[model samples]
Target: MKRLMFYCQHILGIGHLIRSTEIVRGLTNDFQVCFINGGEIVKGFEIPDKIELVNLPAIKTDTEFRELQVPTGFQTIDEVLEYRRDQLLTAFNRIQPDVLMIELFPFGRRRFSAELLPLLDRAKAHGTKIVCSLRDIVVTKQDQVRHEEKVCKLINRYFDLLLIHGDPAFIPLEASFSRTQDLNCNVHYTGYVVQQGVGIREQKIGNGKQAASTHLPTPLILTSVGGGRFGHDLLKCVAEASKVLETKIPHHIQLFTGPFAPDEVFEQLQTIAQHRHNLTVDRYTPNLLAYMQQADLSISMAGYNTTMNVLTTGVRSMLLPFTGNDDQEQTIRSQRLEQLGVVTLIRPSDLHPEAFADRIIECLQTSPTSMQFDLGGVKKTANLIRAIVHKQPVIV
Candidate 1:
């Protein structure tokens, strides 16, 4: 069996780790897979026993992009780089994988470029097939251009293939990368890799269900605001919407304030939801897809993973994307999906609780459009990696 090393980082939310887990799950049956994750957050994932996980000593970043201080007395970037380099080299030496699958950072993750570049050099010298996996959409035009240039330069020098997890019809490469023709020879669109299996199919009777069983109301609504880094507005909107619709609608609302939400913000949300028996506040659910699967109407921000999850679960959702950061990729993607009639898009500026609640009521009354897209390509992604390792041509 070919050995594969999968590398990814989880900063804000667990989306990267979640998607990487799905990819690893697809590959583990046929390949000797080892995961190299940077942060301590990897422990939260429900990975298979066969997979090897190595958690490197990496600092987590706050919403403002400041790196959290490590216990080590050293404070300089070089010190961090040296530590990471040693960890990466040691792991690579131990595993000696045939293929290295890097998630993001071909064009970005500049901080780790010091270590990653040397590792790439070593991998190429050893003839390991290097695959750079990218999500459907990149964030901004300038960043995307810079990323494209970096990919072209490094891919030509060292990398073997570019695997994009989106259909070309929905989002063509040329739109994001100006020099798409130059990299066309090595590019492959592997379609969307959604989370799968028995976990998604079965609904566990946890706190969510137990609470619902106790005091039930009409048309259950589930809303999530991703990592809560930029969710203060979303929470305020939900609260306003609940108050406005308290007398108008007879439904109960389930709001998930993400794991990263501050304690003070969560307390405020609790206070707002206290009196209304129809409103429920939950913090950090692992199985968010399960709730989305059962919800009559869903409200959420249009983060990449959240949008894909909503699409995969076929939830009738109203998306409110976070603005003010360089994170408008969600809005761009959500708008496209809305054009395809998959979900509804609501801008943060246009959010009114009364209007949002009315829209929710309308969506709940209507039938959800059939999800006609085939998501089996997630497995195909693993197959492509296997073929690359064996020096066989990929069918797609």
Candidate 2:
């Protein structure tokens, strides 16, 4: 089997890492895979047991994405970068992978260029096939034209193919990266990579983590913040909204405060939720998709992964995109889906406790129309990679 080395660094939320995990899991049956995780360690987030996972000294950034910090005090940012760089290059030398799959490089994770740039050099030196695993919409930078120009330069120099995990008719690479016309690598769209849906009963429910019980409520409202670093406002709104909507809707609100949420914030939400029998709040659970499967409605940020869940599970949704750090990727995605009648978009201002409660009531009164989305991303990605490796003609 051809060896594949995958690299991903998630600074704020687990969405990127979660999406990467799905893709890597699909590839494990075919490739000798090595996954390099370059983020603050998530204690319970599980990866497949078979792949060789190299967890580098974990690094994370502030909610603003302005400052990079080491979770462990063993090294300064400069020292940690050097150590991670050496670790990555050493792994590269040992594997001499036939394929190097990078999650969101050039398009994002530009901050890790200290090590990533050199890692690319090593891969090229070894004649490895380089792939960029990107999401549907990219987070555009301030100098977008210049930003995209540099990205094109990097792609032309090293990458063999770019797998855009989205339907171009909905949102193309050109939506964010203005210089898509200038990039030299082959770009293929592999549809939306949705998390697989499984029956909640089939799961083992380990770690004292409660599954979305069959007995919870008549109509469950699932609310989640993808990574938890910046969702306090959303969660707080939902917690309060549940109280407001209790008498009106009589539905249960299940809130996931996210694993990275501030301890105080999580505690505060828990305290507020405990008084109401209709509201439940927790830190994290691996069975988010299963909950989405059972939910009557979902209220969360419009991140790629969560949106895919709404689309796949056919759940009515009210989306409030994360606007921190001036990132418009989620907003762009939510708008497109809203236009297609897949979800109702919520503004930051609309997140006021009463307004959110009213919006939830509105959503409960209405049902979302299911729109046909390209949900073949995971399978198509595997096929595309396989065809490229074997030099076989295939349609994307």
Candidate 3:
């Protein structure tokens, strides 16, 4: 079997890690996969047993993306950088993968250039086919022209293929990166990579109808913050909103604060939930989609993976995009989804509990119009990689 080494670094959110693991799951049947995770591990995040897992010196950033923090070990930033760089090079030398797949390097995660640039050069020297796995939207920098130019230069020099995990009909690369015409590598859109078979409702064979799900007796309102590194205010507001709606609306509220939520934040949410019988709060769940599949309404921050789950499940959703560090990726995505008439956008100004309860009620009462997207990203990505590794015709 052809060996493929996949590298992913998620500094702030778990969306990147979730999406990368989903893509790697599809490639295991065709390729011997070595999955490289450079972020702090989220407990209970599943990886395929067939793949070799490499956990590098885990590092992450604050919510503002200001500086890197060594979450567990006592090593300083400089030591971690040097050790991580050497570790990546040594892994590349040992595995000698036929294809090197990187997630969001030139488009995002620019701070890791110290290690990534060297690894790219070494892979180029070894004649290993290089692929870039990117999401639909990219973060905008201050100097737009200089940023795009640098990205184009690096992509053209090192990359063999750029697989964008989104549909062009919805949003293309040029929407964010204007200079798509500049890159020399082969680019393909693989639609949106979604968690397989989790959020979808099953069908019954005899009645030709959807089977009954494990839904709660009352109306279910599900809210989550991706990774829990940020978005404390959102969850807290949701808890307060539940109290406001306690007597007005007959609904059960469930909150998934994510694995990285601070201990104090989780405890506070639990305390708030203690007073309300209709409200419950938890830290993490491996099967979030299953709950989303059965939910009457979904409320959460607009991250790539969660949005994909909403799209996949066709659930009624309200999204409050994270605007930290002037990041526009989530807002851009949320706006498009709203335009499609499937989701409602929540502004920061609308976080008041009494007012937000009305917003939640409005969403629960209105059914979302069904829309279709190219959600076959995982299978298509596997096919593209197989073709690239075997020198077969590139077909998507």
Candidate 4:
């Protein structure tokens, strides 16, 4: 098998890492994969056993994207960046991969151009095929025209193919990015990449239609905030909402306040849950799909990975898109999904305990309409790479 080196960085949230890993997992059978992760590792996040995962000196940013933070051992951002740059170059030289796959480079994560531009130059010199693994929606910048121009230049010069992990019928890349005509690389839509084994599991109950079970069992409410760094308000509101609904509804609420949640926030949630018998708080879980599969109502942010999971499990969901920093990726996706009748949109004004609790009750009573999405991104990604390696044409 040809060796493929994959680079992924998660600055504030784990959505990017999770999506990239799912894609990497699907490529293991076809390629000898070397995964390079450039962010702090979450404790329980599973790394695929079949691939070589290189964890560089971790660096992250604040939720506002203002400052770069280095871990305890590092003194400054410069130190961490220098070490990471050296480590990445070393790994690429050692792996000598036939393909170098990078996630969200030109489209986002522009801060890492210090290291990535060098890596791209090295790959170009070595005659390696470069690929950009991108999500459906990209974050819009203030200087939109300049940003598009830079992205097109970088992509045309370095990347041989651009694999968009979305369905065109749902929302094409052009919705956010208008410079597709300017990019010279081969671009293809691989549908939406979902976690493996999405629908194979047996469904225990209907998809969020039945109310609090009047029988011997209680209903389940599942909530998660991706990475937990920026979702404290959402989780806290859900915790308080659980208290408000405790008397009116017979249900158990399980909150996964992601792995990166601050210690104080986690402790606060624990304290809140201590008095509420119907609520529980945890840091992280490797099996979120299992929870979604069993949940009658799934409440969380409208991130890429979580939304895909909700859609695949056919679970009733309330999506509160992260609106910080004027980021509209999640909002755009959530609005479209809501329009499709698969999810309920939670606005910023609905964060109050009483209001949120009422919304939960309303969502639980209504079933999400079953809709078809192209969930075949994994297989198609692998096939596309294989065809590219073999110099064959694939109908995109």
- Pairs of residues at least 3 apart in sequence or in different chains that clash in candidate 3: none
Q: Give Cα distance to truth, residue 104, candidate 3, Å.
A: 0.3
RMSD of each: 3.1, 2.5, 4.7, 4.2
Give the better candidate number (1 or 2) by lDDT.
2
* Candidates 1 and 3 compared by TM-score, better number: 3
Model 2 local distance difference test score: 0.86
lDDT of 2 by residue, 62-122 (tens): 8888889866756578788888999999999999898999999988888788999999998
**Models sorted by lDDT, best on top:** 3, 4, 2, 1
> Which candidate should be chosen as best, given lDDT against the real structure?
3
Give every collision pair in model 2: none
* Whole-model lDDT values for every prediction: 0.73, 0.86, 0.89, 0.88
lDDT of 3: 0.89
User: Where does the lowest 10-residue lDDT sum fall in candidate 4?
Assistant: 200-209
Question: Candidate 3 regions off by >4 Å?
Answer: 71-75, 199-215
What are the per-residue Cα lDDT tens digits for candidate 4 across 73-188?
88877777777888989999999999999999989988888888889999999999999999999999999999999999999999999999999899999999999988888899
TM-score each candidate: 0.89, 0.95, 0.94, 0.94
lDDT of 4: 0.88
Question: Could you tell me how far off, in angstroms, the CA of residue 273 lies in candidate 2 after the best superposition?
Answer: 1.8
Model 1 agreement with the true structure over 1-396: per-residue lDDT tens digits: 879898886666666777788888889878899998875463234777889988777555666555654525567767876787788778888889898888876644666787788888878888888888878776554466667777778767877888878777777655556676776436778888887633333221322345324223447688888766667777778877887777887777888788777888888888888766678786666667767766778888887678777878787888887654466567777788788778888876657777777877788777666656646557778778877877787764
Candidate ordering by TM-score (highest first): 2, 3, 4, 1
